[model samples]
Target: MEEKKMGLMKCLFVLFAGGVIFLLLLAIYPFWLLFAKVTNLIGVKGIRNTSGKLQTPVVFYEHSVTKRIVAFVAVIHIAEPAYYAAIQELIDSLKGYKILFEATGKLSPQEEQALTQKEKDISSQFDFIFDLMKKINELMSLQYQKDGLTYSASWINTDMRLYDLIRAFAQQDISLIKKGRDIDDPFTEEFGQTVARWFINKLFSRFIPVGVVLSVVAFFSRDKRVAKRLILDARNEIAFQGINEYLKDSDIVTIWGAAHLSGIEKCLKKSGFREVRREWFTAYTVRDYSLFDAIKKGMRATKEAASAATALKKD
Candidate 1:
């Protein structure tokens, strides 16, 4: 009876350990898949180094029949100043190439001032998100794209208007403004807005990494289809249209967010463009002090301390 009990307990312990390992792998699989997809889209083979530094890529595609070149300059919104400088230098080198850049509903000062109250309110909500992004940039010791890159008057904007985006989201029954609101709450829209603002303020105050926060927000969003359709598909279609209409047989240079590149690449491939060259740029290096690094540092400190003690004894 004792032998049988021992065997049963061992079996149960093995099963429990296996279950825990399976659960851990299951939890990690989605993140690994996402990372793989992102790297594939941006033409990055291995994004991270041993030290946890990440690199992004810029891909160049050429039309098969026309032989015209199109350079897709993938960019992060916030990165080291040197990254933007390298991008600017690349743009300067392509002197005659027409630049197609990404900016949605950018308004002139006069146009901004003339917006109606509702429009102003909607704009302010978007501005709040941008402000949070800027705060994150500052927290990460990174430079904002707007400050880092010089914009040219000649570059074309291949993005939709803010009102158009709102309409698209509304069609999908997704309210961008009320996105964070509690559905069970019995309150006015103003109350919801206030609560949302307070929540965002608290969230940003914690100084969480922007990428992690964005991934969490995306994962928790109620309508993922809406985001895919409006943010990625529709925007990509507009960019494709701009390329077709404006970039007729000219060596085109596009500056867009790295996330948007996959969709744009699909469109380009369908239009006879194939990726010819790829270059990786180091965006930022996060210093991850691993166990080995910590041990090395501790040993150096101990050696220094011992040397100091020996000198004190000699004195």
Candidate 2:
């Protein structure tokens, strides 16, 4: 009976250990990401630039998403230095565009404030999985850094009311979105092979050394939540960004997650927009170092503490 009890205990230990490992693996990403964000607060001193370079890949001979010739820009959201730089460059590049329609879902502060206190609380909780995501998404938001950007939630999905958002997740209807398609649109096959290839490429890249490199790049990047925040919400504004712009402007620079590019392309082509050119940016490098960056932060912390102590002594 003692031996039987010992065997059961060992089995339980193994399961417990496995569960712990799984949980840690899931969390390791946010850990490194948080570390990067924290270090960024002090600046990347002694760090040999742990960021990815900007490259615009012109892999599509035609409009990658819409099959119509439309100008589209792709940014890797989960990658470092590359993500931050691409966003600013994209914004700055848009010098005199009369209309800038942002499909990336974000908070409208003044608009939300107009709501009643109860409505405000309900509204704030819509996009947030945790309170931390809400705060993080707001701070690290990119489009708001520049003027003339509008948050148009209904551009992608017309019925995105506050209550509709709350109920969609409860009904588990989000999963069925991709499974359904535009039954009215017959030109879907123009991108069929291309979309299939893109999916397979992404799948294989994640399993290979490339994926490992991407993981490292993601940590070094700031505002990782900004681009990724779209993934969690039931409404995907990224797909509609291109077409939404097409309705108002001839020249459009749509910055969205790389994975969402194809759909945006399809939407653009359906609206008669065309891609003019493409560019590629470097994402990761082994030459960059972060050890000294961490040390510099430590040193700064000590210096601040010492100064505080000196002030207290003088007092």
Candidate 3:
């Protein structure tokens, strides 16, 4: 009888240990995404606020008591950088649902190459602009290193490029800027200087109306409000596209900033989704380091390691 009792106790101990290990694994599973979001240095957290009410983290789903639609939402707030693996996990989880990502537009091949060159080029004339942008990105990265912070450098670049593009269009000699025939310069006397202004404005607006409008709006209006409007419009389009393409035939999942999703959630609610759910996904935050800051941190760590090694040698 004593031997049998000892055997039973041993079996219980093994089972308890296994259960504890499994639980710990499950808890830390979300951290694995640190590689994609933080390591790659690209990605945003989805977060939003609307109607004076903050959207909290809650999983939304729809079921009809006896049946389920198998649809759901998993929101990743971009306040903190997201891991690429987290994105993959999000895609896998929502594999049952259609996926829509609210993000900055992709750079044109030429634009991307140009931007890369701009970063690498050592130009005395453009150093001021280069340093300004580097500083801005560094600061932005640091702020976003905080928990619940999501950001997209792509969005920042896009806005800057669009503004620059439109300004160039507005200020350049349009007829001659792109190897086109010059408009009769002699006609300026007939129409007056106002004609020149009107002609340029019209040309700029017609070429890329969105940028033109945004530029003009920005000149007179606050920047954040304009960005919010643009993001809202983009969110609506993404949601609509997803619903139209996948709602009836397949499931969908979307990744975007939390702020953008408030608009999307509203769209989903109005579109007859009985229940909308959200899940708060988290990853370790990285401090946004400036070029200087990164260098400093590296040197500090190296010095510490060297000091420890010297101590060991003396001992």
Best-performing candidate as measured by lDDT: 1
Cα lDDT for residue 204, model 2? 27
| Candidate order by decreasing lDDT | 1, 2, 3
Question: CA lDDT, every prediction?
Answer: 0.69, 0.42, 0.41
TM-score of each: 0.62, 0.38, 0.37
Worst 10 residues of 3 by lDDT: 173-182
Better of 1 and 3 by TM-score: 1
Off by over 4 Å in 2: 1-69, 76-82, 98-164, 170-249, 271-274, 282-315
As a TM-score, model 3 comes out at: 0.37
- What C-alpha lDDT, on a 0 to 100 scale, does residue 94 get in candidate 1? 89
> In model 2, where is the ten-residue run with the lowest total lDDT?
44-53
Candidate 2 structure lDDT: 0.42
Error of 3 at 138 (Å): 8.5
Top TM-score hit:
1
Residue-by-residue lDDT tens digits, candidate 1, 6-63: 9999999999999999999999878866764454344322232222345666889999
Error of 3 at 220 (Å): 10
How far off is residue 31 in model 1, in Å? 11
Candidate 3, residues 1-315, lDDT tens digits: the string is 999999999999999999999999888656633432342232222322222112223345443442234233334332224433444555465444544444333345665455432232312223343343343333334212223323333211112233233223233312111222223342233232234334433332222233334546665644334444444554455555655455566555444444344565566655656564555444323232244444455557667777888999999
